[model samples]
Structures are given as C-alpha cells and as structure tokens.
Target: MGRHKALPYVHRTFRGWHVRRTWVNTGEVSQLNRARIVSAAIDLIEREGADAVSMRRIAADLGVGVMSLYNHVPNKAALLDGVAEAVLSEIEFTDDPSAHWTDRVRAQARSFRQIAHHYPRSTMVVVSRQLQSSSGVIPVEYALSTMLSAGFDGREAVQLLRVFIAYIVGSLLREVGVTPTFAPVRPDVDVAAIDGGLFPVVASLAGELVKCDHDEEFEFGLEMLVQAMIVRRGARASTSEPPESGVIPSPGLS
Candidate 1:
C-alpha cells in the first residue's frame, strides 16, 4: 500500500497568487457572512458618518472584493436596513410582567437614548430610516403590546408611540448637534452683539441656554411626557364606559 500525501491550500487574487498555507480552517472562512458584513458596515458608519460608508470601503476593511459584498447585501439601501437593524438590536426589552407600562416606556426611552449617544455619528442614519427589520420591529411590538394591554386603544397606542419616537429622535438630533436644515452654529457666538434692550430676556439667558446637559434635558422631557400620559390614561379610563344609549357624548360640546 502507498502512503497518501497532504494537499496544500492556494490563495489567489485578481493580481496574482498570494501566499499558500496549509491547514486552512473552513469554519473561519464560513464566519464571513451577512452578520459580519452588517457589523463591518455599522463599524464603518460609527467611525465615519453614513456618507463615508460604501461597498468598496467595507470590502477593503474586510479584505474582500466589493462585488462579494453584494452576495450578502443587495445594495446600499439594503445595507442601510441592516445597519438600522443592528442599531435597533442594542435595545433590550424587559420580560418582567409586573413592571408598569409607564416604567416599560421609560426603559425603552432610556435604552434608545443610550444607544443613540453611543453611536452619535450613526444616530442620523439609524433615526432617519424607517426600520422594517425584525430587530427593529421587536421593540416596537413590545411597546405597542404593553400599551394595548394597559387599556390604550389602537389609535391612542399608535399616536402615543409616535409621540415617543418623535421626542427621542428630536432629542437625539439636538444632542448630536445635527439641526434639521443647517450645520450647528457655535454656542460661543457673541450674545452682546444682539440689542439687549430689544430682547432683554433672550440676551439674559443666552449663556444658560447655549450650554445643555443632554441627559438631564432628555430625562426631564421624558418624565413630563410620561406623567402627562399617565393623567391621560386615568382620564380615558374614567370615560371609557358608554352612556345609556351606548353613545358617549363628546366633551367640550353641548
């Protein structure tokens, strides 16, 4: 009987053959998949703004061909969806059934805030797009279910969810200094240039107004909204019972 000989692995590129090594791990090769691609894209977005993210850049970062990325993500739009999902997955929903709905809402809000702050550069990318990924849907579904189980009607639940989303996105934008229509102006702009007599109050508080503690501001606003919603929930519950004719009269009318 003849002894069998071991085969060597060859590494090739478009230019030429690269270094050949034995004992290649197939498992390591399989690790480069969709999740890895999405993670690389997210890292690119985090290091540089979304504008800096591209298939070519990501491929270079991963030491793969740009065309190879398409096998995982169809296009930039799909890649962005993945990135959004990746960001959304950072929010963990609590499984505690005994937690109050308001507490759940607060937890979600805080989670969103922390994630947004963690990736300040990528916040715009995360918040600007409408998320359709499962990871994105999980937190939303959790919040909606909590609200519905807590006695909020479909319309009220949806509207309240929108209010929370809008508040958080707006707060994130302000915190990240990304204004809607223009670059952020320096806070150190001279306040004395403005006529003090014409805008006395504005001039007086300019210093305080310019300096913001995003965490404190977010918490204050969130607490106020939560308290207001709590009052609204109580009021809604009180008026939930229908009249004698099964037709409840609208308030503030005859």
Candidate 2:
C-alpha cells in the first residue's frame, strides 16, 4: 500500500530527469549544427568576399535549406558572428611562458598579419561583428591576463592591445595593397600605366614596400612599448617607495 502511494513521486522524479536529458541532447545537436554552419561560411567567405556571402550560398554549402539555418541562428547577421568565431579559433599560442613580453606580443601581432594574408576577408568579418562571442574574447582575455601578470592596469592593457593591433593591421594593409573597396583593379586593366605617370614617387618606392612578414617591426614596436611601461612603473616605484626596500623592477629588453 505504501509503495503504491509513493509511485507518483517516483514517476515525477524520473520524468524531470528525462526532461533534462532531452534538453541536453537537443542543445548538443544545435551546437554541432551551428559549428558546421560557421565552418561552411568561413570557407565561402575566404573563397569569395563578404559581398558574396548570402543565405543561399551558405545553405548550399551546408547541404541544408536557407530556412533550416534559422532554426539554430536567428538570421544572417547572427551567423556571421559564428563565422568570425570560427575564424578566430585557428590562432594558437606557444606553450613557453618564459619568453619576454615583447616576444609574446610580437607573436600575437605576427599571427594577425598571417591571418590577414591567408584569410583576407576575415578582417571584414571581425570588423563587422561585435566581440560579444566567446571566440573573440579568448585572445583578448589572454592578452589582458598576460599584460596584468606583467603588471599593467586595465586601461593600459587595452591601450596596448589597440596600439599593437592597429600597427599590425595597418602594416599588413599597406603591404598587401589589396584592392577590395574604393580601389578598383579592373580585370583587363594594365598593371603599370595609371600610377607610372601620375605618382612616380609612389611607383619608384613601391618596391621598397615592406614585406608581409611582421616579426621585425612587431618586435621593435613591442620592445619600445614594454620598455616604456616598465620605466613608468619603475619611476612610480622610486617616487613612492621606502628607500630601504630597493625591489625596483629590473628593466630588461622586454
């Protein structure tokens, strides 16, 4: 009689567990599909341009209908977020932490330059989408942690990120001279006619343009910034410290 009375409670507990399991399975499936969609979109955009990325294009690549993607993602804009996340996942960091801060920052800068070379359209995706996605924040968070461990505040860390990113991106853009927008290279146009007569100096020094390799410039810039920051920290310590404790930061080639 007691067993029968408690049967309802047992059934409810099992039912609740079943519901949770079902929801977990559904979530897993959704994530898998979203990853596939993002990978397909990245491939398409790399082969084509941002202007060429359409719902139909992505759907065709995914072997699913355009409406089917909406089940996982609300719209194309949301899908682009996934694509940017997918593109950023390719970045890998070295395991050696003993390297100088300059080396670490320069490594990250060089990675960006290489990504720009391999995936030219990725910059557009990164620029267009917000960094609200987890993939976008991973590298940024790594940068901040590295900076903080090296003794930097939030504002200073962010400023250095901005400066480092801008230098690498701008340098790559100049090096590649990609004719994506406003600058047009017609299919049938001659390569050296227009600039030869009008901008001789630009043409003359065109050969002097820096290579796509960013190791040298990145190291130099990172070295300067890190040194300046260390000096600033040292100056602050000297001004406000007990002369008895001479634990000032040793300024090295970081």
Per model, state how many residue pairs clash: 0, 0
Give me the displacement of residue 122 in model 1, in angstroms. Answer: 2.9
Which of the numbered candidates is closest to the native, going by highest TM-score? Answer: 1
* Candidate 1: Cα lDDT at 85: 69
lDDT of 1 at 108: 75
**Each candidate's lDDT (Cα)?**
0.69, 0.58
Across 147-252, the per-residue lDDT of candidate 1 in tens digits comes to: 8866789999999888988899888877666663222255445665667899899778766755656788889999888766765666677344332232234452
Pick out the ten consecutive residues of candidate 2 with the lowest summed lDDT.
2-11
- TM-score between model 2 and native: 0.61
The local lDDT score (0 to 100) that residue 224 gets in candidate 1 is 83
- For model 2 the local lDDT of residue 26 reads 27
User: Model 2, range 1-254, lDDT digits (tens) per residue?
Assistant: 11111000101121111101011232234433665666567777878877777778888865678888788778788878876765565555542357555456656666666666666676668756777755577668767766765566788888877777776666556445554322232334333444768877756654444223445655666667655666655554423322212334554312
Error of 1 at 81 (Å): 1.2
